[model samples]
Target: MGIPVDVISLYRKACEHDTALSGYYNRNVRVESDDGPVMVRVPSAGAETMDLAIWPEAALLDAIGPHVPSAPRLMHANIDPPFQIQEFVEGALLDDAHPAGAALPDAVLDDIAAFFSQLLAVPVGELPAAPSDWPKDGDTASFAELLLRLVRSIRDRGDQSTARLYRDLGVPEDPCGLLARRVTGLSTRPFRLLHADIHRKNVILGADRTVFLDWELALCGDPVYDLADHLHKMSYLPAEDERITAAWAQVAPPECRAGWEEDLRFYRAYERMKSAVVDTVRWARLIALAAEPQERRAYAVELADKLDAARPCWIPASDTVLTPDDIERAVDRWSATGGTG
Candidate 1:
């Protein structure tokens, strides 16, 4: 959590090895460098192409470069380790400056829509098909299964608090059952390019520019899924949502747009339910640290706050504080005591 400043300076000096080198994750000192900042990308190895590829954060800017001149350009890249040298456009983190949860001004939201407009316009045919490992279960029918698999992955890891969170929340089971039982006849749209993880952290704000970063999860399927991701994570007001909704509508056929909105709502819920596994794991990991008891307890409370924020939209579980006893219950449910990751 703490960064060492001297080490940072030394890393900056790494530019010397390959003058073009901006920097790299974990100094291997093997790859040649370049003059300016560079980006490193690592597509998930041994996986199918449809699975999320670890594109450099800089590429997000590159995606918008034709439309926005001030946006960062990705100069170079290394896919093995997966990092990039981006322009590092200076500005406040979007969440800090636009604290209404990325409730940006009209100009800012327009810029975001413009970026997506460009992205959706490009012919996805040019993009390669996902590798063999890309999850075959990516369609609407597979949604519940995918959520279960991810949850099962988490449960298999055996972190008590996380496991407890699922048992307490009833997870994809509860939500998926509701969808199948209530949200009638949901249709599946084949995959399209998606910025599947479009949270505020991935959007960088500048004085005159707002750049989206982190496109590792982009895949050529289910564009609606991406829209839902952005809306769910950022929670922009109806206006922001409407604008983005309209932008995508421009590229989609009228019929596609009509069905898309309804489907997006479902996927949005699916994403939140699935993301809870990750969030609970995050909290459990922090609580397990050897840090002070106060730190652990503090994180436990913070976990509650995160769940609370996630609840009004998704996360139907009670707002109970996560306690060791809760985890023990999950551990019993999982029939394991460790690594329910």
Candidate 2:
């Protein structure tokens, strides 16, 4: 189907009015379409760091929408400028209402579990084309190795200027080596579609339905990793965390949930280790580009928090943990040395 002319028109108008929201990967604008309000999303092209996508998100959404009702309905998509128009979910973000470390309502928990069950049930052939090197279903070890390779690629391409700053912040010389060694012993499990990135911001709580957004980070892998990723990002209360884990296990296929109690720790550690690498590079860029004192300090504080969050996964712990004040001082010293590349 051709991209709707009217939607394109609306998108242009939205852009002109400066209503576009610049997120990490896309610039989104809300516009009214004939069917109802829709969101127009244009890719940020080169501005993403954690995107470990093997398939185009639009194709993934189209293939899974029938099975996963929580996924947003694709209204129209264009490749020339790389934008997609999806049904704009009306309501609030799950984060806005619940926030991190808060307990979720029972209904919301059920909704999350249902989303996972439905997505995992989709046959592999039904989804979009994956990379030729993509791990075969049930190859948990290969999948883990693939993640390591992809993250290593990101690190290699990262700015060399940030290397010194990362060291100063206690980031290990090589963060993923331990994970690579550990994944060798991963037990085999049936693989299926994993949302891969499902934090509160990606969820919309509407009047009638909950919608999951942003499939750019989706991957085919052990379903247990998805649960681990969710737990790490949401920071749900300990009680709620246990409840959600139980709920997920109840609905998940037994084959998919096998050895989850033990495997979950490995995946969680991988997530933390991945964060340390990604956050360091991102923080360097943000710190270097920051224009105002307040903005620079805010980014420094965020860097501190992210580093602290990933501290447990650091293979060899740094000399000392970094506080916000420590980070700010490091940033200043690093900047003075012309380390901002």
Candidate 3:
């Protein structure tokens, strides 16, 4: 797709110097400007519209500037057009270096642990308010409540294809209450800033240090949640996963380590359910709107694979794990419903 005219105009006005479009996705663009490379992120064109909060990454980068040497710096932003210009940090994505399902090197693991330790130290008072849907600081009930809200929202907004997937999977009617029960009796840890999404793709391995990217999902929550997120998303080997957990326990604050083993299980299950919902919704959209039959089929298969991977994490074993054939049938049914159901 062509880059938006307003983004092109912003690049010209900001640098006046020659600019090269380095990357483009949806409406967000990365341009190499005279000053330096910058990322122009457009909020309206993305899929996360349900989130009502203004992008908090720039404000967060400002607050933690002194402490986090590797975080990208915010250069400028405009709310009128909903564009953010941020310094583009240069480094290989951790996934690019260590592919998914591979063991991460010890050095990388240590750097990641240290990164979380420092992030938790940033005073929440200096940061902007988190997204309204996010749980308030240390409010364990809010954690489960937020997940339940999201599940309900997805069901309400999703079409028949998504509903069918949910039914086939036997997703609980009251996931929030279920999650709340699972997490009850856990010792409450002091809340701190958490990069709620810390997979390999968001970790940039720099020459001297590791820089975290895409703070858009950042929030204030239990620090252990961050560790659980990283462990689940990184696809670490079983042995490596255990070692990394041990390393994090050694470095994480004492309060953060309380009920670490049990809490990780709860967090992992939550993450899996959350991922399943998101993927199912995306697949439904693709089935309805994607013009290419090949593309729709590809995404359906991918989503099915993701659902399968998350099967083990479901609180109660799901009734049915979706297969590629089942997804294709759902897509056909969606088409038959004229994309309305």
The prediction achieving the highest lDDT against the true structure is 2
- lDDT by residue (tens digit), candidate 1, 114-162: 7666556555444545566454423644543444455445545544544
Taken over the whole model, the C-alpha lDDT of each candidate is: 0.53, 0.80, 0.67
**What is the TM-score of each predicted model, taking all chains together?**
0.64, 0.91, 0.80
Reference-based lDDT, residue 121, model 2: 87
RMSD of 2: 2.4
- Output the TM-score of candidate 1: 0.64
Stretches off by above 4 angstroms in model 1 are 1-72, 79-83, 100-103, 133-148, 159-184, 188-190, 237-255, 288-302, 305-341
List pairs with backbone clashes in candidate 2: none
The list of candidate 2 runs beyond 4 A from truth reads 1-3, 284-302, 337-341
Tens-place lDDT per residue, model 3, 49-121, is 3321234566777787887775777777555545578767667878888998777888988887788778877
Point out the higher-scoring one by lDDT: 1 or 2: 2
Judged by whole-model lDDT over C-alpha atoms, candidate 3 comes out at 0.67
lDDT of 2 by residue, 1-341 (tens): 76677967877856665766566787778887677678888887677566577878788889988888889988777787678888888889999999986778999988988888887789988988778878887999998887788667766664455666777788777667777778878889988888888999889999999888888888888899899999888888888889888988998887887788888989888887777778776686677678997898888888877788777766785547677678777766677767555
All candidates in order of lDDT, best leading: 2, 3, 1
